[model samples]
Target chain A: MTAAADAPPTAALPKVRVDYLPMLLVPLLMLVALPLVGSVSTWVTLTVAALAMGMMIFLMASGLTLVFGLMDVLNFGHGVFISFGAYVSLIALGPLAGWVESDNLLLNIGVLLACILVAMLVTGGLGYAFERIVIRPVYGQHLKQILITMGGMIVAEQMIHVIWGASPIPLRLPEGLRGAIVIGDAAMEKYRVIAVVLGLTVFGIMHLVLNRTKIGLLIRAGVENAEMVEALGYRIRRLFVGVFVAGSALAGLGGVLWAFYRQTLTAGMGMEVNVLIFIVIIIGGLGSVGGCFIGALLVALVANYTGFLAPKLALGSSILLMVVILLWRPQGLYPVAKR
Target chain B: MLPNNPIHSLLSGDYPRSRVLGALLFVVLICLAFAPFLFPGSQPLNVAAKICVFIILVASYDLLLGYTGIVSFAHTMFYGIGGYGVAIAMYNFSPSWTALGVGVIVALVLAILLALLIGLFSLRVRAIFFAMITLAVASAFAILASQLNEITGGEDGRSYRIPEMLRPAFRLFDEPVMGVMINGRILTYYLIFFSALLLFLLALRVVNSPFGRVLQAIRENDFRAEALGYRVVVYRSIANCLSAGMATLAGVLMALWLRYTGPDTTLSFAIMIDILLMVVIGGMGTLYGAVLGAAIFILAQNYLQVLMGQFSGMLESAGIPLLPGLFHADRWLLWLGILFVLSVYFFPVGIVGKLRQMRK
Candidate 1:
């Protein structure tokens, strides 16, 4: 009895068996794709590209899914945050033009870091305002939220045009980040490798924070049963606001990465990728972050492969993938338990 | 009790309910009925014709978004199909009355079938899911239209010759009537007007029917409607199909009027937004709101740019930084977007709803 009492209460908790089935999907898809794609080097190149693209998409979608899960708000204007982030980076990087143009890898990295930090801060603040002004009144009403957020998107996109001018601004990659790094017969872009690393780091941090921290625990609990969490005397509203702001900031960060990848900044860039994001989130299940991650990878991989195999069918491939996945699991790949 | 007259029956007993709204509808009807004679210029007539076409389009959309509580982004896709159907037929075949007939019938069938498929596939899911799916499908359709250059003529789109009776060169009379030339253009305008009126009336009839009541019930509470033994999906799908059919007709009218069909004119997302603005601003759930909203929105779209340009100049002269640019004619959508948000918040019922409420 003394030994049992000495053990922590957590020791008595049942183990949460992680669902490994969904986790195998990424490698499974890659393996299936490898056979279909005959040339090894081209396949490797495509895989790396797909991974980088998937990471960018994951960065954009994770926040949206969490927001939907915790608050039941499908912000149609989520793409605006990405545009805002990218535009903010444009301004932030302007003063550090020397660092951007420099050959030194450390200087280039520093410039990128500073640009990302500023974008996150500005977009985070903007998100707070957006949640307060645009989203607060429409809380608990999904229809109005979708309509109002869409209006917000239209206004924000126009504002971007007004501020940056309508013409597309060319964004040059930093000297150290440009070009490709050869891995055997295959070559991967330097920026893409960095993007993969950054994406993995973000995912790791998110996983750790969500599983280990008290705030993260509260957020997870809130997602499952918001009223129950509130009944337990926790301020779920404040937690939601925090999540909203953080989601916006993450979207902004993703936007910066996406802009660098394209190297062209258009006002509609955010909106153009919006359809893909919607597809990703829907396929991942509306409210699950891990599902969103896998969904993004699946979509990017299918898109890249099909783009190589049959360019005409590339755009339709993702939609087809969504249809197939939905048929398999109507609630999405990893349906949130609440729904 | 109201008189059992044809006009009353035609209106389906769903009157505007407000004296002011009735008067406004009457005025719009009169303006559209005699648009060519009343408006002497080509631009005003063009605006009038556009108003007529959009009234039908917007009203049909109201059936889904307002009455059924379904938001679909693929409405424009069906509209494009109708336009392309007519455009392609007329392009391939000789400019004949049969060509027009064949084109319209084929388009109506295609639009209805596509709508049915979309409804069956997506209406089973949540409204948000349906909206996103429609959006994806619509964008894909637009891309497909553009990519299939030989059929759709790619980005520039296909411009085909209409029948002789509708061409601008064909005159009804040698002499000018009431200072207006009696040409095919005027005939075409009249064709559009009469068809719009008939279609609008048909829509009104449908909405006031028992089926429409079921849709409204479903819109109010789907679960309750289901509990009450109404097949909610069936009603929604039917509403979707009917709305698509009407939108397709409106597209046919537009194609006939323009003599050209392009992705920009028929299927652009901007036009979809415009439709939404008209629905919200005019008043959702009320068909009459579509009439007012479409007319007002189109008028503003045409004339407001000039007003905005002057406002921008005034702001520039005032040395107000950013105000000038914000008020630029090209940025009219920004103002409209703000209005849309405000309207959704403050006037969820919209202009017609407000007017009717005032009367009550």
Candidate 2:
């Protein structure tokens, strides 16, 4: 797998070939969409909106893909974490109403950061308990895992209704985050810009951590072959638990951003987004983070463009995209090796 | 092997295998058969009809999940198609027997075709992939149904008239039989009960046939089954189509009985979850479990809300904290969810499996 002969003699690094084909899909899709969109201003607005939505999705989906890659557990209840995160933010933001309404940008940002932090913490703890209780028993059995996790999802969703009163709660954006910035002819919401920035930062950190750190290396290796990593004397189980919790926390973070973007909250909102998330991960090739990011962007772009172009076909667009991609690539855009 | 009787032949030689289960099945059968006469109320009759419909739905699901070991979230999609088909046909055309026949045939054909396509496409992948793909497709279909307001009646769904024979105004006689009115509702109830019974027996026959053995073999180990030269994909796809067709029939019965076809009634994910719970709780891989599971679940769904309300009231008066909220009538599903998860972990064989195990 490694080209040792072509490697530089000085450092003796393995010459690994990275597949950049999937990486080019995001821009390629955008360029293809531009003509169909007709107007440059509308195209720019849709593209930015798509990017913001894609980032939020990536935040939620990255952890899920990682958990699946490292350990073959697809938690159907992952959406529960998203819903819980959003609700936690509701509770957290209740006391910070003043900060939310404040005229100062810093206070507004602070309130959001505080909400995100609280949500991440609460959902992360929930993830730990869920992993131990619900998922630990059916590790290798895919059927039971799907059933049990679905059961867990139903219970969690009902619990949210019991706690949240089964009504849609309205969430108002901060003073500074409201309104839009007009760039040329296109107008972009301030919150969308902030979301894009936050999503990018998170993605950047994940990229560095997964590529540069020892733990990242272990996770990658474990995803490829857990038994080999364990035979090498590493605690793959512990690593899996950590990844699961972190993935849930990321979902929570995404939930917070998604709630603010919508300015409303419902118990089923997480579930509503879950279909898109699954499509994203599948398109990206389950377990590949970079592929998931691109997949998210592709799905979001298609959704936005279709919603604007043909409102009726918007929902089916992503599924159509998945079908075409699967037919072409079979596994996904970037299939994980040995899976 | 020893006895050649009509009952055994009807059941396809698959007995209850446990006295308690056999007794339970008999009681359920009698109760459903005499529901209108014994209960003499609309509510009880409604619950019985619901049980009848669910028995078929859950049994068909067992054919895929329990027997073939395929976990699909698209079963309800086919069910919805059946409901919508009948609803739309009756809505558009005359409320005649031709409309009913046309609707049933169209729905059955559509359901089987869709099931085959999904099976052929996703069944080739891992079970997990199939599950996820079905979930995505089903959810998309739900959205489409809700969005297409003109045709589907949108979120409100369509409530249309059935044939004159099935409508409640039609009467068989001027007098009451055994203190029960001989109205069209009773006729409809009998129609559902007979159809459900026949369809359920057909499912049992399918699961007991040689084809059923191949499904079980594949479920146990696909590689070994493939080694034995049984085309695994073809068998699984056929199983998928069969299950989908049965579920569609159950939906058609439901639409006729309810006189309505709505997203909440037929296409909701909640119903899918309910089907899963019934299959797992009653017993997987056992056709008879569908009967018991559907009965228990429908009864709980109809009656447990009242019971939960009472418990919540008592807890509230006693000044308990979250206990009352947890036991509130709307939270009935929480208990079922917990029960379902526990059953999967502890009683993977479900009630039928457990009862038979006790007998052994």
Candidate 3:
């Protein structure tokens, strides 16, 4: 006992346990609170909308958090991917909207898949170029990275404004999800339900991929110590590119959902909402996948609740929560690493 | 060493004391006092006055960044806070001597308290995390201000009627040019300029003083400073607080000059970037760079637009429609970003340092 007393305390290190019980329970709690929010059917509609918004937030925050946690690079222009996806989908749906207008289901499905494919490819290419050209140069300097990325954000925004013009184009939803589903006095959009269901499915798949795959192991290891991972001769540069592309792809998917949900794709929306997304990431704990979901839901709730409580004070609540979380847990609720 | 040591020379030890500064300032002031009349009704004077105000802001920013080696993304927040303080005071109460005075005092107090809070947290973090926190807080503050419609005036931004100036027992500027009294753009410009000049002198004194030397020492080697009796964090916080106080003064002046305060004026990204450009271009970490930078920036803004207008025909002939950039319809910041990047990459010492180096 005396000899063992010389050992250093292991308490300094945080033991990570990745069972996602609390995250699962969060949604369940929301579902339970639904009746209290409104009538059962009205609750259903809001719940669906809330869940859908939550998923989009989750996807955006996940990629952002992952990159920031591992690379210590804040990708300020990340919202561009989502906008790109929306634009790509919007263009694809341009002609198909007419078909949908005529009640054609077959054309709509084709348009949806084609749009996602184009968006994924375009955004991936963009992510690849951006990673190599802009992001790679200012690797070690955070200030340079921020200034440069901010410049990129401005450039991206302007480029979008130039192409799309300064108008909010209605995102043509499929005729199938056009109107609200009436459940007694309460009505909710079907697209909102779709967004939640689709987002969750993606989340499940992402969870499996991260937990089970070989690339997942490398990524997890890389997140732990990027330099050491590189030293192990594992094509870490390629990994960085791949991760970036994947992250951008997730943002693109989010953009498609955003188009349908918001029913509009505007240039300024990317930057405006990106700030809140950043807050979500910060509060969620940078780089943690589950944390992003939790953070997104929390932010969504704050946004929703604030509007209900006092419409004038909507933005107030988000900041209030962020400040509280920051002061309480400076590293966030579940910080990725000390660095 | 020959007749003089290089270390002494390197410090740029040529000091222009009280008499020299007094004469220079007197001549400059006299020239400036008359220049408004010379300009007659030139809009450029208005622009120049605003430019001076921003110059003060950038210089204060340099105190934190270039001098102390601290990178604060939220420096503009202090400026905004000061602006808001003045706006609230004058807008709610009638604008008067008492109102502006009370506004400035309150702003200073708030700046000190905020600086203390931010500085305390700032000591616990470094680099990107620090940058993130500042940026987040700044954004949050702006958003919160926007959301608090009742007090802050929300999205449309609250406007206070120009406060009546109480006659200070006797009239000071009875028949000032471009006005019946000391108010409006030209007068506000002078007010900002003189305040900035005094503030610059104050900042210069801080840099040259023992406290300034200690700060530089800490910047160069924080561990060594810590190893000594100095509590590094406390001094850093003090410097930060001082900078914030100065910025608050600037903000109060802004509210006065603009005659209104809103989110646009208070929480403007363009303003933030402009201040940064001023610091970087003028020769950051130098006593005189802020003035040089601001002068250059304003000149560029005015002259660049003129150049573009003059070259419109040439651009048309060259089959290139003038893309005057995105800052305004007249000017743009893409050019500024390019200039900032190049300056950082190359002549990072800025105009003043470059000139000194050239002299060397």
Q: Distance (Å) between predicted and true CA of B19, model 2? A: 0.3
Runs with alpha carbons beyond 4 Å of true place in candidate 3 = A1-16, A19-42, A82-102, A109-113, A166-174, A184-186, A310-313, B1-38, B121-123, B161-185, B213-232, B309-331
In angstroms, give how far residue B203 of model 1 lies from its true place: 0.7
User: A36-55, model 1: which lDDT tens digit per residue?
Assistant: 89989999999999999999
Per-residue lDDT of candidate 2, residues A1-339 (tens digit): 479756667985568889988888889988988989999999988988999999999999999999999899998888999999999997779889999989999999999999999999999999999999999999999999999999999989999988888889999998899998998999888899999999999999999999999999999999899999999999999999999999999999999999999999999898888888999999999899999999998999999999999998998999999999999898999899988
> Quick one: best DockQ, which candidate?
2
In lDDT terms, how accurate is model 3? Answer: 0.71
Chain B TM-score of candidate 2 stands at 0.99
Which candidate number has the best lDDT? 2
TM-score for chain B in model 1: 0.98
Q: Worst ten-residue run, lDDT, model 2 chain B?
A: B1-10
TM-score of every candidate relative to the true structure: 0.97, 0.98, 0.84
Q: What is the interface RMSD of each candidate, in Å?
A: 0.8, 0.8, 3.2
| Candidate 1 lDDT, B1-360, residue by residue in tens | 365987789899998989999999999999999999998889999999999999999999999999999999898998899899889999988778898899999999989998998899889888988989988889888888988888999899999999998999999989999888989989999999999999999999999999999999999999999999999999999999999999999999999999999999999988988999999999999999999999999999999999999999999999999999899999999999999999999999999999989986
lDDT of 3 by residue, A269-337 (tens): 666567778778877777777777888887786566456546767756777777777787776666777
**Could you give candidate 2's per-residue lDDT for residues B1-360 as a string of tens digits?**
445888888999999999999999999999999999889889999999999999999999999999999999999999999999899999988788899999999999999999999888889888889999999999999999999998999999998999998889999989989888889999999999999999988998999999999999989999899999999999999999999999999999999999999999898988999999999999999998899899999999999999999999999999999889999999999999999999999999999999999998
Candidate ordering by lDDT (highest first): 2, 1, 3
Please give me the DockQ of candidate 1 compared with the native complex. 0.77
